[model samples]
Target: MSQSQLVELDEAAVLGHAGQALAHVYFPTDCLISLLTHRVQPRSFEVGQLGYEGMLGAAAALGVSASAFDAVVTGAGRAWQIELPHLRALTRASRSLTLLMTRFLYFELSQMGALAACAHFHTLEQRLARFLLMSVDRLRVADLKITHEALSLILGVRRASVTLAAGAFQEQGWIQYSRGHMLVLSRAGLLQVVCACYRQDLSTYDQVMLGSTAAQ
Candidate 1:
Protein backbone atom coordinates (compact mmCIF):
# COMPACT_ATOMS: atom_id res chain seq x y z
CA MET A 1 0.00 0.00 0.00
CA SER A 2 2.91 2.34 0.68
CA GLN A 3 4.03 2.00 -2.91
CA SER A 4 0.58 3.11 -4.15
CA GLN A 5 -0.16 6.80 -4.18
CA LEU A 6 -3.53 8.11 -3.03
CA VAL A 7 -5.13 10.77 -5.17
CA GLU A 8 -8.37 12.65 -4.80
CA LEU A 9 -10.54 12.61 -7.91
CA ASP A 10 -13.01 15.41 -8.47
CA GLU A 11 -16.43 14.82 -9.94
CA ALA A 12 -16.61 14.78 -13.76
CA ALA A 13 -12.80 14.70 -14.04
CA VAL A 14 -11.71 12.87 -17.17
CA LEU A 15 -9.15 10.17 -16.43
CA GLY A 16 -8.96 8.62 -19.90
CA HIS A 17 -10.09 9.92 -23.30
CA ALA A 18 -10.68 8.20 -26.61
CA GLY A 19 -7.49 7.22 -28.44
CA GLN A 20 -5.35 8.55 -25.60
CA ALA A 21 -2.63 6.28 -24.29
CA LEU A 22 -3.05 5.48 -20.63
CA ALA A 23 -0.18 6.44 -18.34
CA HIS A 24 -1.54 5.06 -15.10
CA VAL A 25 -3.89 2.39 -13.81
CA TYR A 26 -6.24 3.48 -11.05
CA PHE A 27 -7.43 1.27 -8.19
CA PRO A 28 -10.40 3.04 -6.68
CA THR A 29 -10.96 2.79 -2.94
CA ASP A 30 -13.78 5.26 -2.43
CA CYS A 31 -13.99 6.80 -5.89
CA LEU A 32 -16.17 5.77 -8.81
CA ILE A 33 -14.98 5.76 -12.42
CA SER A 34 -17.42 5.61 -15.35
CA LEU A 35 -16.42 4.65 -18.87
CA LEU A 36 -18.35 6.84 -21.32
CA THR A 37 -18.90 6.07 -24.99
CA HIS A 38 -21.01 7.42 -27.81
CA ARG A 39 -21.67 6.95 -31.49
CA VAL A 40 -23.08 9.27 -34.21
CA GLN A 41 -23.08 12.19 -31.78
CA PRO A 42 -20.32 13.40 -29.46
CA ARG A 43 -22.07 13.00 -26.16
CA SER A 44 -21.15 11.36 -22.88
CA PHE A 45 -22.90 8.07 -22.25
CA GLU A 46 -21.76 5.62 -19.62
CA VAL A 47 -20.89 2.07 -20.72
CA GLY A 48 -19.25 0.80 -17.53
CA GLN A 49 -18.32 1.72 -13.97
CA LEU A 50 -15.52 0.71 -11.57
CA GLY A 51 -14.89 1.19 -7.90
CA TYR A 52 -13.13 -0.49 -4.97
CA GLU A 53 -13.71 -3.83 -6.60
CA GLY A 54 -11.70 -3.05 -9.77
CA MET A 55 -9.04 -1.09 -11.57
CA LEU A 56 -9.06 1.16 -14.63
CA GLY A 57 -6.45 1.07 -17.44
CA ALA A 58 -5.09 -2.41 -16.73
CA ALA A 59 -5.35 -3.02 -20.46
CA ALA A 60 -2.33 -0.79 -20.85
CA ALA A 61 -0.20 -3.43 -19.20
CA LEU A 62 -1.33 -5.92 -21.85
CA GLY A 63 -0.19 -3.53 -24.65
CA VAL A 64 -3.62 -1.97 -25.18
CA SER A 65 -2.51 1.52 -24.29
CA ALA A 66 -5.13 3.66 -26.01
CA SER A 67 -8.49 4.19 -24.38
CA ALA A 68 -11.69 3.57 -26.36
CA PHE A 69 -14.02 5.41 -23.98
CA ASP A 70 -13.91 8.46 -21.73
CA ALA A 71 -13.10 7.33 -18.22
CA VAL A 72 -14.41 9.97 -15.80
CA VAL A 73 -14.52 10.34 -12.07
CA THR A 74 -18.21 10.25 -11.31
CA GLY A 75 -18.16 9.75 -7.57
CA ALA A 76 -15.41 11.91 -6.10
CA GLY A 77 -13.00 10.23 -3.70
CA ARG A 78 -9.52 8.76 -3.47
CA ALA A 79 -7.80 6.00 -5.45
CA TRP A 80 -4.43 4.30 -5.64
CA GLN A 81 -2.54 4.74 -8.89
CA ILE A 82 0.48 3.02 -10.42
CA GLU A 83 2.43 4.11 -13.46
CA LEU A 84 1.79 2.03 -16.56
CA PRO A 85 5.42 1.21 -17.23
CA HIS A 86 5.92 0.18 -13.63
CA LEU A 87 2.82 -2.01 -13.64
CA ARG A 88 3.86 -3.63 -16.87
CA ALA A 89 7.25 -4.38 -15.39
CA LEU A 90 5.64 -5.80 -12.25
CA THR A 91 3.39 -8.05 -14.31
CA ARG A 92 6.39 -9.26 -16.25
CA ALA A 93 8.25 -10.07 -13.06
CA SER A 94 5.33 -11.71 -11.25
CA ARG A 95 3.22 -14.39 -12.91
CA SER A 96 0.55 -13.99 -10.22
CA LEU A 97 0.27 -10.30 -11.04
CA THR A 98 -0.13 -11.12 -14.72
CA LEU A 99 -2.82 -13.64 -13.99
CA LEU A 100 -4.71 -11.21 -11.79
CA MET A 101 -4.65 -8.57 -14.47
CA THR A 102 -5.90 -11.04 -17.05
CA ARG A 103 -8.79 -12.07 -14.84
CA PHE A 104 -9.72 -8.46 -13.99
CA LEU A 105 -9.60 -7.27 -17.59
CA TYR A 106 -11.87 -10.11 -18.67
CA PHE A 107 -14.35 -9.26 -15.91
CA GLU A 108 -14.26 -5.61 -16.90
CA LEU A 109 -15.16 -6.46 -20.49
CA SER A 110 -18.15 -8.54 -19.41
CA GLN A 111 -19.29 -5.71 -17.12
CA MET A 112 -19.06 -3.22 -19.99
CA GLY A 113 -21.13 -5.45 -22.27
CA ALA A 114 -23.77 -5.94 -19.61
CA LEU A 115 -23.97 -2.20 -19.00
CA ALA A 116 -24.29 -1.42 -22.71
CA ALA A 117 -27.19 -3.81 -23.11
CA CYS A 118 -28.94 -2.55 -20.00
CA ALA A 119 -28.59 1.03 -21.11
CA HIS A 120 -30.11 0.35 -24.53
CA PHE A 121 -32.96 -1.96 -23.56
CA HIS A 122 -33.97 -0.91 -20.08
CA THR A 123 -36.23 2.02 -19.26
CA LEU A 124 -34.71 5.12 -17.68
CA GLU A 125 -36.24 4.40 -14.28
CA GLN A 126 -34.99 0.84 -14.30
CA ARG A 127 -31.55 1.84 -15.50
CA LEU A 128 -31.36 4.60 -12.95
CA ALA A 129 -32.28 2.24 -10.15
CA ARG A 130 -29.73 -0.31 -11.27
CA PHE A 131 -26.93 2.23 -11.46
CA LEU A 132 -27.91 3.80 -8.18
CA LEU A 133 -27.80 0.42 -6.49
CA MET A 134 -24.44 -0.30 -8.01
CA SER A 135 -23.14 3.05 -6.85
CA VAL A 136 -24.20 2.42 -3.29
CA ASP A 137 -22.53 -0.95 -3.33
CA ARG A 138 -19.27 0.63 -4.47
CA LEU A 139 -19.42 3.60 -2.15
CA ARG A 140 -20.73 1.65 0.82
CA VAL A 141 -22.62 4.74 1.80
CA ALA A 142 -26.25 5.56 2.24
CA ASP A 143 -25.94 9.09 0.89
CA LEU A 144 -24.99 10.12 -2.63
CA LYS A 145 -24.33 13.44 -4.27
CA ILE A 146 -25.33 13.75 -7.90
CA THR A 147 -26.76 16.31 -10.27
CA HIS A 148 -29.53 15.50 -12.70
CA GLU A 149 -27.49 16.85 -15.58
CA ALA A 150 -24.54 14.66 -14.63
CA LEU A 151 -26.76 11.62 -14.39
CA SER A 152 -28.33 12.47 -17.75
CA LEU A 153 -24.90 12.58 -19.35
CA ILE A 154 -23.94 9.26 -17.77
CA LEU A 155 -27.25 7.44 -18.40
CA GLY A 156 -27.74 8.88 -21.89
CA VAL A 157 -31.13 10.25 -20.90
CA ARG A 158 -32.68 13.66 -20.53
CA ARG A 159 -32.33 15.42 -17.21
CA ALA A 160 -36.10 15.61 -17.01
CA SER A 161 -36.29 11.82 -17.02
CA VAL A 162 -33.86 11.63 -14.12
CA THR A 163 -35.98 14.19 -12.30
CA LEU A 164 -39.02 11.98 -12.75
CA ALA A 165 -37.23 8.84 -11.63
CA ALA A 166 -35.82 10.55 -8.57
CA GLY A 167 -39.24 11.89 -7.64
CA ALA A 168 -40.88 8.52 -8.04
CA PHE A 169 -38.21 6.81 -6.01
CA GLN A 170 -38.71 9.39 -3.30
CA GLU A 171 -42.43 8.81 -3.25
CA GLN A 172 -41.81 5.12 -2.78
CA GLY A 173 -39.55 5.90 0.22
CA TRP A 174 -36.54 4.60 -1.63
CA ILE A 175 -34.57 7.81 -1.42
CA GLN A 176 -34.71 11.45 -0.47
CA TYR A 177 -33.51 13.38 -3.48
CA SER A 178 -33.31 17.13 -3.76
CA ARG A 179 -30.83 19.82 -4.71
CA GLY A 180 -28.23 17.47 -6.12
CA HIS A 181 -28.19 15.36 -2.98
CA MET A 182 -29.73 11.91 -2.51
CA LEU A 183 -29.91 9.81 0.62
CA VAL A 184 -30.70 6.20 0.01
CA LEU A 185 -33.32 5.31 2.56
CA SER A 186 -34.27 1.85 1.42
CA ARG A 187 -31.80 -0.48 -0.26
CA ALA A 188 -34.41 -3.23 -0.24
CA GLY A 189 -36.90 -0.96 -2.01
CA LEU A 190 -34.35 -0.08 -4.70
CA LEU A 191 -33.62 -3.76 -5.26
CA GLN A 192 -37.29 -4.21 -6.02
CA VAL A 193 -37.28 -1.61 -8.79
CA VAL A 194 -33.93 -2.41 -10.40
CA CYS A 195 -33.80 -4.80 -13.35
CA ALA A 196 -32.42 -8.32 -13.16
CA CYS A 197 -29.26 -7.12 -14.85
CA TYR A 198 -28.05 -5.70 -11.55
CA ARG A 199 -28.30 -9.01 -9.74
CA GLN A 200 -26.84 -10.89 -12.68
CA ASP A 201 -23.89 -8.55 -12.78
CA LEU A 202 -23.30 -9.11 -9.09
CA SER A 203 -23.45 -12.86 -9.49
CA THR A 204 -20.97 -12.73 -12.34
CA TYR A 205 -18.65 -10.59 -10.24
CA ASP A 206 -18.88 -13.04 -7.39
CA GLN A 207 -18.06 -15.96 -9.68
CA VAL A 208 -15.28 -14.42 -11.71
CA MET A 209 -13.78 -11.71 -9.50
CA LEU A 210 -14.30 -13.12 -6.05
CA GLY A 211 -14.04 -16.78 -7.01
CA SER A 212 -17.07 -17.48 -4.87
CA THR A 213 -19.43 -20.37 -5.47
CA ALA A 214 -22.14 -18.67 -3.44
CA ALA A 215 -24.41 -16.56 -5.61
CA GLN A 216 -24.63 -12.85 -4.92
Candidate 2:
Protein backbone atom coordinates (compact mmCIF):
# COMPACT_ATOMS: atom_id res chain seq x y z
CA MET A 1 0.00 0.00 0.00
CA SER A 2 3.08 2.21 0.17
CA GLN A 3 4.16 1.94 -3.43
CA SER A 4 5.90 4.95 -4.91
CA GLN A 5 4.39 4.90 -8.37
CA LEU A 6 2.59 7.33 -10.64
CA VAL A 7 -0.96 6.71 -11.79
CA GLU A 8 -3.30 8.47 -14.16
CA LEU A 9 -7.05 9.03 -13.64
CA ASP A 10 -9.66 9.93 -16.18
CA GLU A 11 -11.98 12.96 -15.96
CA ALA A 12 -14.55 12.80 -13.13
CA ALA A 13 -12.78 9.85 -11.56
CA VAL A 14 -13.53 9.89 -7.86
CA LEU A 15 -10.33 10.29 -5.92
CA GLY A 16 -12.54 10.22 -2.85
CA HIS A 17 -16.21 10.67 -2.09
CA ALA A 18 -17.73 13.24 0.22
CA GLY A 19 -17.94 12.18 3.87
CA GLN A 20 -15.70 9.21 3.22
CA ALA A 21 -12.55 8.86 5.26
CA LEU A 22 -9.39 9.06 3.21
CA ALA A 23 -7.35 5.88 3.14
CA HIS A 24 -4.55 7.15 0.92
CA VAL A 25 -2.99 10.43 -0.04
CA TYR A 26 -2.06 11.45 -3.56
CA PHE A 27 0.93 13.53 -4.62
CA PRO A 28 0.34 14.80 -8.10
CA THR A 29 3.34 15.12 -10.39
CA ASP A 30 1.54 16.69 -13.36
CA CYS A 31 -2.08 15.90 -12.55
CA LEU A 32 -4.73 18.34 -11.29
CA ILE A 33 -7.67 17.51 -9.07
CA SER A 34 -10.49 19.70 -7.85
CA LEU A 35 -11.95 19.70 -4.35
CA LEU A 36 -15.65 20.38 -4.79
CA THR A 37 -18.49 20.88 -2.38
CA HIS A 38 -21.60 19.19 -3.68
CA ARG A 39 -24.96 20.47 -2.57
CA VAL A 40 -28.32 18.74 -2.40
CA GLN A 41 -29.37 20.79 -5.40
CA PRO A 42 -26.51 19.14 -7.34
CA ARG A 43 -24.62 22.43 -7.51
CA SER A 44 -20.91 21.99 -7.03
CA PHE A 45 -18.10 24.49 -6.93
CA GLU A 46 -14.39 24.06 -6.64
CA VAL A 47 -13.17 24.81 -3.15
CA GLY A 48 -9.56 23.90 -3.83
CA GLN A 49 -7.18 22.42 -6.38
CA LEU A 50 -4.21 20.05 -6.19
CA GLY A 51 -1.26 19.71 -8.50
CA TYR A 52 2.43 18.73 -8.55
CA GLU A 53 3.07 21.36 -5.91
CA GLY A 54 0.88 19.67 -3.31
CA MET A 55 -0.84 16.53 -2.02
CA LEU A 56 -4.55 15.65 -1.92
CA GLY A 57 -5.14 14.06 1.49
CA ALA A 58 -3.88 16.60 3.97
CA ALA A 59 -7.17 16.41 5.86
CA ALA A 60 -6.50 12.84 6.96
CA ALA A 61 -3.20 13.99 8.43
CA LEU A 62 -5.14 16.52 10.48
CA GLY A 63 -7.21 13.66 11.92
CA VAL A 64 -10.33 14.38 9.93
CA SER A 65 -12.44 11.25 9.51
CA ALA A 66 -14.35 12.45 6.47
CA SER A 67 -13.99 15.20 3.88
CA ALA A 68 -16.59 17.85 3.21
CA PHE A 69 -15.61 18.05 -0.46
CA ASP A 70 -15.50 15.55 -3.28
CA ALA A 71 -12.06 15.06 -4.78
CA VAL A 72 -12.12 14.46 -8.53
CA VAL A 73 -9.41 14.09 -11.11
CA THR A 74 -9.86 16.88 -13.62
CA GLY A 75 -6.82 16.17 -15.76
CA ALA A 76 -4.92 13.01 -16.58
CA GLY A 77 -1.36 12.88 -15.22
CA ARG A 78 0.90 11.01 -12.82
CA ALA A 79 0.30 10.95 -9.08
CA TRP A 80 2.15 9.20 -6.27
CA GLN A 81 -0.04 7.25 -3.87
CA ILE A 82 0.70 6.47 -0.22
CA GLU A 83 -1.45 4.74 2.34
CA LEU A 84 -2.57 6.86 5.30
CA PRO A 85 -0.56 4.92 7.85
CA HIS A 86 2.59 5.25 5.79
CA LEU A 87 1.95 8.92 5.24
CA ARG A 88 1.50 9.57 8.93
CA ALA A 89 4.64 7.64 9.81
CA LEU A 90 6.67 9.45 7.19
CA THR A 91 5.32 12.81 8.31
CA ARG A 92 6.26 12.11 11.90
CA ALA A 93 9.72 10.86 11.03
CA SER A 94 10.64 13.62 8.57
CA ARG A 95 10.68 17.25 9.57
CA SER A 96 10.85 18.21 5.91
CA LEU A 97 7.62 16.38 5.19
CA THR A 98 5.96 18.00 8.19
CA LEU A 99 7.03 21.42 7.01
CA LEU A 100 5.87 20.69 3.47
CA MET A 101 2.45 19.63 4.69
CA THR A 102 2.17 22.63 6.98
CA ARG A 103 3.07 24.98 4.15
CA PHE A 104 0.56 23.34 1.84
CA LEU A 105 -2.17 23.74 4.43
CA TYR A 106 -1.43 27.41 4.65
CA PHE A 107 -1.49 27.68 0.86
CA GLU A 108 -4.86 25.94 0.74
CA LEU A 109 -6.30 28.34 3.26
CA SER A 110 -5.07 31.30 1.24
CA GLN A 111 -6.59 29.83 -1.92
CA MET A 112 -9.94 29.49 -0.18
CA GLY A 113 -9.80 33.10 0.90
CA ALA A 114 -8.95 34.21 -2.64
CA LEU A 115 -11.76 32.16 -4.09
CA ALA A 116 -14.28 33.81 -1.80
CA ALA A 117 -13.11 37.27 -2.75
CA CYS A 118 -12.92 36.51 -6.47
CA ALA A 119 -16.42 35.12 -6.59
CA HIS A 120 -17.86 38.30 -5.10
CA PHE A 121 -15.76 41.02 -6.75
CA HIS A 122 -13.96 39.89 -9.87
CA THR A 123 -15.50 39.83 -13.33
CA LEU A 124 -15.80 36.60 -15.30
CA GLU A 125 -12.97 37.54 -17.69
CA GLN A 126 -10.61 38.32 -14.82
CA ARG A 127 -11.59 35.14 -13.01
CA LEU A 128 -11.10 33.12 -16.18
CA ALA A 129 -7.64 34.58 -16.69
CA ARG A 130 -6.63 33.75 -13.13
CA PHE A 131 -7.97 30.22 -13.54
CA LEU A 132 -6.04 29.61 -16.76
CA LEU A 133 -2.79 31.00 -15.34
CA MET A 134 -3.13 28.84 -12.25
CA SER A 135 -3.83 25.70 -14.31
CA VAL A 136 -0.83 26.37 -16.54
CA ASP A 137 1.45 27.00 -13.58
CA ARG A 138 0.33 23.83 -11.81
CA LEU A 139 0.62 21.60 -14.88
CA ARG A 140 3.97 23.23 -15.76
CA VAL A 141 2.92 23.11 -19.36
CA ALA A 142 1.94 25.79 -21.83
CA ASP A 143 -0.78 23.69 -23.41
CA LEU A 144 -3.72 22.38 -21.35
CA LYS A 145 -5.64 19.46 -22.77
CA ILE A 146 -9.02 20.30 -21.27
CA THR A 147 -12.40 20.99 -22.76
CA HIS A 148 -14.66 23.95 -22.00
CA GLU A 149 -17.03 21.51 -20.31
CA ALA A 150 -14.34 20.45 -17.89
CA LEU A 151 -13.36 24.06 -17.39
CA SER A 152 -16.93 24.97 -16.62
CA LEU A 153 -16.92 22.37 -13.86
CA ILE A 154 -13.68 23.74 -12.45
CA LEU A 155 -14.80 27.36 -12.74
CA GLY A 156 -18.40 26.69 -11.64
CA VAL A 157 -19.73 28.47 -14.67
CA ARG A 158 -22.12 27.66 -17.46
CA ARG A 159 -20.67 25.83 -20.45
CA ALA A 160 -21.84 28.58 -22.77
CA SER A 161 -20.05 31.18 -20.69
CA VAL A 162 -16.79 29.25 -20.72
CA THR A 163 -17.02 28.87 -24.48
CA LEU A 164 -17.57 32.60 -24.94
CA ALA A 165 -14.70 33.51 -22.65
CA ALA A 166 -12.38 31.09 -24.38
CA GLY A 167 -13.32 32.62 -27.71
CA ALA A 168 -12.47 36.05 -26.39
CA PHE A 169 -9.13 34.88 -25.09
CA GLN A 170 -8.33 33.34 -28.45
CA GLU A 171 -9.33 36.47 -30.35
CA GLN A 172 -6.98 38.51 -28.17
CA GLY A 173 -4.11 36.11 -28.93
CA TRP A 174 -3.79 35.35 -25.24
CA ILE A 175 -4.59 31.68 -25.82
CA GLN A 176 -5.27 29.20 -28.61
CA TYR A 177 -7.82 26.40 -28.33
CA SER A 178 -8.05 23.38 -30.59
CA ARG A 179 -9.86 20.12 -29.97
CA GLY A 180 -10.22 20.56 -26.20
CA HIS A 181 -6.65 21.73 -25.79
CA MET A 182 -5.74 25.25 -24.78
CA LEU A 183 -2.34 26.77 -25.47
CA VAL A 184 -1.15 29.84 -23.71
CA LEU A 185 0.32 32.16 -26.26
CA SER A 186 1.47 34.86 -23.87
CA ARG A 187 1.79 34.30 -20.15
CA ALA A 188 2.47 37.93 -19.47
CA GLY A 189 -0.57 38.95 -21.42
CA LEU A 190 -2.80 36.56 -19.49
CA LEU A 191 -1.43 37.84 -16.19
CA GLN A 192 -2.27 41.35 -17.23
CA VAL A 193 -5.80 40.29 -17.98
CA VAL A 194 -6.25 38.53 -14.63
CA CYS A 195 -7.19 40.17 -11.34
CA ALA A 196 -5.11 40.57 -8.19
CA CYS A 197 -6.38 37.32 -6.67
CA TYR A 198 -3.98 35.27 -8.78
CA ARG A 199 -0.90 37.10 -7.53
CA GLN A 200 -2.15 37.01 -3.96
CA ASP A 201 -2.47 33.23 -4.07
CA LEU A 202 0.96 32.86 -5.67
CA SER A 203 2.53 35.06 -3.01
CA THR A 204 1.04 32.93 -0.25
CA TYR A 205 2.34 29.73 -1.84
CA ASP A 206 5.81 31.23 -2.33
CA GLN A 207 6.02 32.47 1.22
CA VAL A 208 4.85 29.20 2.75
CA MET A 209 6.09 26.40 0.48
CA LEU A 210 9.16 27.94 -1.17
CA GLY A 211 10.17 29.99 1.89
CA SER A 212 13.24 31.98 0.83
CA THR A 213 12.80 30.81 -2.73
CA ALA A 214 12.21 33.68 -5.13
CA ALA A 215 8.75 34.13 -6.55
CA GLN A 216 8.55 33.77 -10.32
List the candidates' TM-scores in order. Answer: 0.93, 0.90
Q: Evaluate residue 140 in candidate 2 and report its C-alpha lDDT on the 0 to 100 scale.
A: 92
Backbone clashes in model 1, listed as residue pairs: none
> lDDT (CA) for every model shown?
0.85, 0.81
For residue 124, model 2's alpha carbon misses the true position, in angstroms, by: 1.2
Residue pair clashes in candidate 2: none
**For model 2, what is the error of residue 94's alpha carbon versus the real structure, in angstroms, after optimal superposition?**
3.9
TM-score leader = 1
lDDT of 1 by residue, 1-216 (tens): 345698999998888887899878899999899989842374567888898998998788877869888898889999998888888887889887777788788888888898888987888888988889999999888777788889988998778888999899999999998787788999899888798889988888877767832333
Off by over 4 Å in 1: 1-3, 38-42, 212-216
Query: Worst ten-residue run, lDDT, model 1?
Result: 207-216
Tens-digit per-residue lDDT, 45-134, candidate 2: 677888888888886765677876789887778889888877888778887777667778778877877886786788878888987888
Q: Cα deviation of 108 in candidate 2 (Å)?
A: 0.8
